[model samples]
Each structure stands twice: as structure tokens, then as C-alpha cells.
Target: MSRRRRAEKRQTAPDPVYQSCLLAKFVNKIMYDGKKSVAQRIVYDALEKFAKRVKAEDPLAAFEQALENAKPALEVKSRRIGGATYQVPIEIPANRRISMAMGWIIQHSRAKAGRAMDERLAAELSDCFNNQGTTIKKKDDTHRMAEANKAFAHYKW
Candidate 1:
């Protein structure tokens, strides 16, 4: 940890189409090795495909819904005591919650057996929006773990 005061949080600009800062941040996280354009293309393409398949509203809405469904409320953290490691259930921060949701969704999508990125991402997003995908399953597992270890809640500072 730094002894000096932490730097201020920088403001982020929204995405070009939806004008959502959250989406922009998600895109930044999705980017690999500074390939931001590729990330943007993949997300936009996935949204476009979803919009065509769903055919009623905007793709951004679906994306937002997916994010909402994927976000986890609580997670268990490992804390060390004198000899044993305890599972401490902690409430996830808002920003981290969103990041984790996105990461899990993207990871599951990448691991799926799909022919194209758009198809895989769209499938994952749809599953997430419907609360029936790997991401949501992962969230459920986390919550279950946290619930199972609720006795360690007092260990949190």
C-alpha cells in the first residue's frame, strides 16, 4: 500500500452508441493487450445480432439486463486465522460487482462451443438476461458458498 494519498478516480466517457459509461468500462475490461477496437467490434457485433434475433427494442437494453442478472450480491473471501482459513462472506462493491458480472459472462461465452463470437456472446447475454447461464450459475454458487459460510461474517473488518 502507498503511504501517500490515493489518486482521484478519473471520469470515464460513455460508449458511442448507447452513451453508457458502464458499457465503456466493460469494453475497456474486455479489451486485450490494448486491442480496444477489437473489443468494441465484438461487443457491438454481439449487440447487433441480439437486436436482430429479439426484434422489439434496442440491444443495449438486453446488454444492461444481462449485466443486472449476472451481478452477484455477496461473495466469500478466504481469511487466515491462527491455523485455518475461514470463508468470510462479504458484500460486493457496486463497481466490482459489475466487473465480475461482465468477466464471468465473457469467460463463459468464450468457453462455449459456438461457431462465432457474435453467436456465443449473444447466447451468453440472452442466458444472462434470462438468468439461466453459466454466469448466473457462477453467481448462485458464490452466494451459496457465502451462505454456507455465513458464520464467518464476523471476521470481516
Candidate 2:
């Protein structure tokens, strides 16, 4: 029997304004109700605000730094060994790391009250850029959990 190959990843075009694929991915993640334009506007406005807040000459660069700071190096995965389940420490791939970081930023921003999405995203990005936000805490927690489960590293198949 032939084995099925993994599906190809759909390619995303860069954002019109900044021409950055990373920003476009972020916009797509923020999109609601199939509103791509609205998501783009919110993200662009937040990046502008982030630029001012971080005093960055290039907001995209600063945003990349924030994203880098939020990416977790390790995470624990459940593995069934014998009759017991073990939490195996595993390294995250680059794409998954980026996806997870973006999700955390959006989640924390959406959790905030009394602010527009752009405002909240801007604040959250600034916090992430400065390495002091819920997103960063989440990443840290993931790392800590993986570290605590390093004894199960051999269980990873």
C-alpha cells in the first residue's frame, strides 16, 4: 500500500501596505466573520501604535522582536507508554512556534475590556516587545512545563 503524503501548506500573499507575509498571517488570524479588510485595518493601526509606543523606526522590526520573545522553545506532549501516559518534552517547529505566539497575543488582547481591538493589540504588542505580558508568561509557562517533563523526552516518538 502507498502512504499518503502530507498536504502542502497554502501560501499567503504579503500584506498590501507593508508587503510582509508575517503581518498578513497575523491579519488572517485576527480576522472575524470573514472580514479580511477589517482585520488588516486593526493590525495596521495597532502596528502604528506599537511603533510609537516602542519608539521604533520600523514597526515591523519591533513587532518581529516581540514575536521572537513570545515564541516558546519547548512544550510537553502527551504520549501513551505501556498503560501510563507521559508528558514528553518536545521542541516546537518554526511555523508552529509563530502560530502559537500569534494566537497567544490575539487571545490576550481579546480578553481585555474597555478598549478597541487596535488599542488593545497595540498595548499587548508593546508589552510583548518589552517582554512583560500574559503572552510572555504563557510562553514561559510552556517552557517550564517542558523542563519539568524532560525525563519523558525519550518517550517522544
Candidate 3:
């Protein structure tokens, strides 16, 4: 952690369709090479496709569901003391937990077998919303690992 005083929090505007700042942040995180337009188009396209699959609600609900399923409640961190390394399991922060979930979902989506970015994103989003996907699996794996290392929870700060 930095020794300096904590910086002021900056506000982010919500996306036009969902009116959610979290969605805006996720779009920004998904952007590659600083191409906001491409990221926006891809996310919007995926949302449109996802919205069609589930009736009565907007795509943002699907996005939120995916995020909820993908977030990891706990994670392990490496720490060194007296020339020994320890894998300490700890609860994740709220903001960072969400960011990690979104990043992993986007990354795994890109790694999937799909013809287009939008298609991959849509598929991943659908799976996550349904509680089954690479991202959700990853979160489960993390939880399992944390559970296995429950004895090390005392090492957390």
C-alpha cells in the first residue's frame, strides 16, 4: 500500500442504455489499445444479443447477473516472512473483486472458440448469467483453493 494520503474518489457517468456506472467501468476494462468505440460497440452488440435470449428485462440485468456469478468471495495472496513464502487466503475487496471478475470473464471470453468478439462475449455472458461459464468456474476454483487453505486465513492483514 502507498504511504501517501488516500486520493479523492472520482465519479464515472453511467452508460446510456443501462444507466449504470458499473457497466461503463466494465466497458472501459474490456477496451483494448484504448479503443473505446470498439469496446462500446462490442459490449452493446453482446447486450443486444443477450437481451433477446431472456425476455422482459434489459441487458443490464444479465450483465449484473453475470457479474454476481463471476465475483470471487475469497482469494489467495503470497506473503514472505523470515525467508518463507505463505499462500494466505483472504476475502477480496468489493471493488477489486468486481474488477477481477469482469477482467477474467473478458479474458476467458476472448480465449473461447467464437467467430467474433461480440459472439464470444454473448456466449460468456449467457453462461455466467445461468451460473455456468469459464469465469464462474474460475471463481469456484478460487473458492475451493481458499477453502483448502482456510488454515492460512490468520495471515491476512
Task: In angstroms, give how far residue 126 of model 3 lies from its true place.
Answer: 0.6
Which should have the higher lDDT, number 1 or number 2? Answer: 2
Tens digit of per-residue lDDT, candidate 2, span 1-157? 7598889999999999989999999999999999999999999999999999999999999999999999988999999888999999999999999999999999999999999999999999999999998999999999999999998898888
Worst 10 residues of 3 by lDDT: 50-59
Top TM-score hit: 2
Strongest candidate by lDDT = 2
lDDT scores of the candidates, listed in order: 0.87, 0.95, 0.87
Error of 3 at 15 (Å): 1.3
What would the per-residue lDDT of candidate 3 be over residues 13-129, giving only the tens digit for each residue? 898777899999988988999998899999999888877765527788778887888999999988886788888998899988998989998999899873799988988888888
Task: Give the per-residue lDDT of model 1 (tens digit) for 53-133.
Answer: 666287887788779999999999999998999999999999899989989988998898847877898888888877897
lDDT for predicted candidate 3 compared with the true structure? 0.87
The 10-residue segment of model 1 with minimum total lDDT is 50-59
Candidate 2: pairs in clash: none
Model 2 scores worst on lDDT over the 10 consecutive residues at 1-10
- TM-score for each prediction? 0.91, 0.97, 0.91
Off by over 4 Å in 2: none
